[model samples]
Target: MPSSVPPFSELLANTRESAVHFEMRDDYGTNPRLEAWQRGERINWDDRESWWHPFHQTIADAVARGVAVRRARIVSEPVSEYIRWEHYATHANVMAGEDVRWLPRSQATGFLVPANDFWLFDGKLIRVHHFAGDGRHVSDELSTDPGDLKLCVSAFEEVWQRAIPHSEYTI
Candidate 1:
């Protein structure tokens, strides 16, 4: 059997005209993979590893190529800890020179949905989905409608305008 998969790539390609999107809730804190990674434990990189994905190459490609990547996070205390444990400690390994835009939930446009939550990326908005709680599962789904992406783009703009710069927030 193949080590990697194709459906995720196909989905991302479908949304190339717009941004990729996802959402999560406090339940994400209970994820085991996340707990281990947060504690600086080693994580296997093989296919059988918990929530593994073969898609980091693509996300890195988008960032390195200077495509505008925007993210609206519902910042909680645990998520904040995860960000520090993951991103700040490995900044050199995570991203090089490209600007990363992260925003607070209130600044973002859409309200948190009752289920998996609402997301519009590259002109598509999806309300219910799941996340692995670690950096392993690449759940980026593509949008079929350009108008959906446009709406997301507009939402990102509204958040981007009111959010603090990463430079200011990163300490």
Candidate 2:
């Protein structure tokens, strides 16, 4: 852990080559969007403007600057409500020029992977996110430790290799 862990936007802005995110959770507690989706609310897919938020904007900007942004998720199925919502909304990520992929938990058997979610920046530094069992965020760390970096980078690449592209994944 470093003394100063920059915010996600700052990390993204500073990344020169690639940014990869590894998400292994099926739920993230609940947000307004998750709650809405849980109540059967759905995005009006035709109206793309309504869903464009700052995160997607930042990702788009990073892509424009030549940073390759990719996200990989290892989820349990038949998916949780949060994952279902994530799948439904992933088109926004695609539109933002991010490559999104999903790997079922069963598909990743026997692989050594991180316990926390993380964003690996330029393959050197990582920002790891900690969450509680019910899926509420707890804390995060920015690390450059050699062992941590090796595991994060390798695990992510393995997951990315086995993951199904967002466009092709079903449920």
Candidate 3:
């Protein structure tokens, strides 16, 4: 790990070619929205004015600057509540100009999936996220190691190839 890992926004802002994210978790613990969703609350996808937060704005800006942003998720079947919410909320990501996909865990058998979630920037740098057993975010680990980068790129590409695009995936 480096002494200093730039913030995600900075990394995305600096990206010139592409930014790819791989999420392999069924639930992200401690999220209030997930809790709300678990209680049967629905997200207002049409309320973009209020829902387009800074993160989405950053992604939108990056796309405007020609950075191809894509996200792929490897999820369990009969998806968890968190995943269901994620699926419901994916329209926002699509509207932000991100390409998103979902692949059931059963279909990811042969790929060398990384243990942690990560954002790979421009095929060179990777910001890997660590989480506690309870799904609380721990810290991010950044790396530019060739082996790590290669694994992330290969694994993500494979998952992306096998995943169903967001428009077609159903929870």
Order of the predicted models by lDDT, top scorer first: 2, 3, 1
Q: Over the stretch 49-133, how does candidate 1's per-residue lDDT look in tens digits? A: 3433355555555555554444443344434566554444233223422233445554444542233333443455443244565
Task: List per-prediction Cα lDDT, in the order shown.
Answer: 0.45, 0.92, 0.90
Better of 1 and 3 by lDDT: 3
For model 3, how many clashes?
0
Worst 10 residues of 3 by lDDT: 28-37
Error of 3 at 122 (Å): 0.4
Candidate 1 achieves a global lDDT of 0.45
On a 0 to 1 TM-score scale, where does candidate 3 land against the true structure?
Answer: 0.94
Q: List the RMSD of every prediction in angstroms.
A: 7.1, 2.1, 1.9
* Least well predicted 10-residue stretch by lDDT in candidate 1: 89-98
Report the number of the highest-lDDT candidate: 2
Model 3 alpha-carbon drift over 4 Å, by segment: 1-3
